[model samples]
Target: MRNTFLKASFMAAMASIGAGEAGAADYRKNPFTLAYDGAITQNEPGKVNIHPVTYKLNGLDIAANVYIPANYDPKQAYPTVVVAHPNGGVKEQVAGLYAQRLAEQGYITITADAAYQGASAGQPRSTDKPAYRIEDIHGMADFISQYAGVDRKRLGLLGICGGGGYSLAAAQTDKRFKSVATISMFNSGRVRRNGYNDSQLNSVQQRLQQASEARAQEAAGAAVLYSGDANLSDEQIAKLPFELYRQGYEYYWKTHAHPNSTFKYTTSSLLDLMRFDATDQIALIGQPLLMIAGSEADSLYMTEDAFAKASGAHDKELFIIEGATHIETYWVPKYVDAAIGKLSAFYGKTL
Candidate 1:
């Protein structure tokens, strides 16, 4: 019965995006657009002139778009940006967008799909285990060093959405990332545990109950239901919890939907995220931190709160771009350029 619910929920989540080729966003301008053969197995990056590499991380076949700066040399070193993805996202998604743009700005960038979420490997597809999530960043650091052109000493991190929180996770514990920055970041563990700004506290416990029941099913070898489906009629969609959430569907589904992409989240993942508090660990980090977010971004406050809570950061600051939404910062030039330029200066100074 739980497996039935999982399938029912999964299909409903897939359909929720109102997904279909004829739906919209045919320009396919993002970096991942170049890799849509739908191979769940590892595939190579197309165009954008990246050197694609496939490697093993914890036995997972990790694929990355490795862009070495034009001035790169085996003897001479260069800075590297280890890019990570948003929740329920693949490397070929928005994270790759950031990676490509950053690489173009003369940094070595490697964007790898997260375990189980994209071309990367893990059984029980789409599971969002927190340990694995944090490990993925550490794994990337180890994975990229083998390249001859990279400066292991000048490593940096750029995470988008949930990736932002994970970047903090990796940075707080691992000293290898000399500098760290985020775009449209989310305190996934905090937000999932206690909604945005704790506003949903009234019902957060009940939602936890529901998620727990779903996880019980998963432990029994049954598939789990996903959260955050976008399916709704015009009126019902308007009733979404937040304005940007509604816009998320417009971006991820109507405007940006690839038949290959999905928003389905693990039913058990919530339990993991609720406990995966990156901010709680931030004080352990000694690197300089650059936390950037959209002024209008619904998730902005978390960045602010994190900045307040971090005690050990050598240097840290938050910049909120005016008139931008969360997803806008993900791709918009006004938002992204602000981020890229600021980050370049930050890393240039710190790393």
Candidate 2:
């Protein structure tokens, strides 16, 4: 049972952003182009509004959405949150959902595609490196902080799934973030290096060697290689062993998929990923922290371990949503509400 659970999580992490071709019809159902349920169709003067924006990060144009509260006034200062998306995720998905919800609660929020993923520009696309992901969080902070009516001292962060892991790394040294939080936190480096729950521990060196070879091939003018890219049929997906895997496929490839989202990453990226650990130097984050996870989430262990090692966060707390799984926390209304409610209180007290 334990091995099955671990294997399911490992495979789920690998395929969380399953591959699919988006057509004109998949451009999104709403004017804002957000793929999540209850996404705002049109901005209203007295309601939460989403602004599409682009900014340069490391010379690459980063696509992002900024959500401002209802009756927003430039003259009135407001606390702000920067949300980081999950692995193979784009700003248009769950990250945007949480950002918009938080905005509706009177906070300014922003969710951007990580460099080289989603609508963001980068060559040899879908490059998933730890440094780039961490910097993306910082870059969002830079842009959002300068926006009108932002209170620099009250800036907060919310990282979802893989973004949660990278955000922990970013907050370690980026003191600019006044408060930090993670929902359904996934430690990407740990999963990539050790496999989910360390089920692939014995093959770590072998995988590293493969990544090194892939990097060499890329340097020698070979075609870029990808990993975790799959176009599974419904029957194939149904036979998957775990709830996380089955539900994740439905979420990313079926119900809430967006064109910019893809499950693959440069195989060479494993070189950097294997060496990265989100919990490394985690104690450097001395700011107040809030870590939320679903009680039934197969990925809950990651959150638990990280929260335990957050020795530097003197005011950290872990809130769990009962009966919620890893992916459920992303879009299930009641679960999302539970998370947002806790986030509201956490940011309210800390920020």
Candidate 3:
């Protein structure tokens, strides 16, 4: 009788473990959660529709969210926007908000989980491999081109936050996207190597040494330690940046929220981004380009630098969304509205 009870208990425990796999997989890799106030978009079911889907790229099962306009017709091919999300974020988070709004404005929009993170495939998951991130964007282009009811020839691209950087890199190589835009972007490699605004350039060697230690510890079978999210306490928030990141967090995680999502990010992804540079082929992107950033944004600096260096476009324009911060522009009303309007016009004109 004792043996039978123990056996039954063990079986029940196993069943519960099996039931938690989906959340377990993501949380173990990243415990942080992102918040978004997308009720206006997500719950408003009529004029826009979002479908969840997955695709495989670089051995990663990338998760994506596709948005179709309310007026969408199965018999018609619609212009598509392949979107990439900010770092430490997912398709269900900020990117979906952006894509859905764009869809409501009449464009077929798709946003994806970066490879090695989110629902995408990458073992030793969430390593934040810059190459894999870039590949994921390229993979998305392929994913959309082959999607049903999409006009492959009439495609555009949009990247948000760090995704903006990757999109820039991908667009230089894949001309299938005739237009591209970035919002509150980051040059992941440069920032990883140098720290925000070169403030840590002097510490690159030390940082690299620390990364080596992390690599060795992993090699020796130590559990990975992540530093991306503070998992901030109320006290910590008081001492944090008064702008960009924290404000955005309040909006996305605290107030307006997506129950299925959070701001979680992989622990080891940052170290790999140190070597990633998306600006190497700016001259190669011959399509229409638009960069949207808040003049007051901490991230706007990188956007400005990239715009200055981008060589392809008499067709490119950089617009500073006047009074906003990096995170505010993520899903805030006025900002999102301006962005959708701008993007719709840009793609409408280009594609």
Highest TM-score: give the candidate number.
2
lDDT of each: 0.73, 0.88, 0.72
List of clashing residue pairs for candidate 1: none
Number of backbone collisions per candidate, in order?
0, 1, 14
80-194 per-residue lDDT for model 3 (tens digits): 9988988767776678778877787778888887765655555565567777778888888888787778998899889998899988998988888889999888888887788
All candidates in order of TM-score, best leading = 2, 1, 3
Q: Model 2: how far is 297 from its true place, Å?
A: 0.4
- Give TM-scores for every candidate, taking all chains together and pairing residue i with residue i: 0.85, 0.92, 0.84
TM-score of 3: 0.84
Best by lDDT: 2
Q: Write the per-residue lDDT of candidate 2 for residues 1-351, one digit (tens) a residue.
A: 323433553355335444354322243457776888888889888999999999999898888999999999999999999999999888888999999999988999999999888777787778999999999999999999999989999999999999999999999999888899999999988999998767899999999999999999999999999998888889999997767778888888877876667788999999999999989999999999999999999999999999999999999999999999999999899999999999999999888
Instruction: Give candidate 2's whole-model lDDT.
Output: 0.88
Candidate achieving higher lDDT, 2 or 3: 2
Winner on TM-score (1 vs 2): 2
lDDT of 1 by residue, 25-144 (tens): 332443434322221222234323466677888888776677655445558777889998887666655676677676666778888877766566566667777788888899889988
| Total residue pair clashes for candidate 1 | 0
In candidate 3, position 303 carries an lDDT of 92
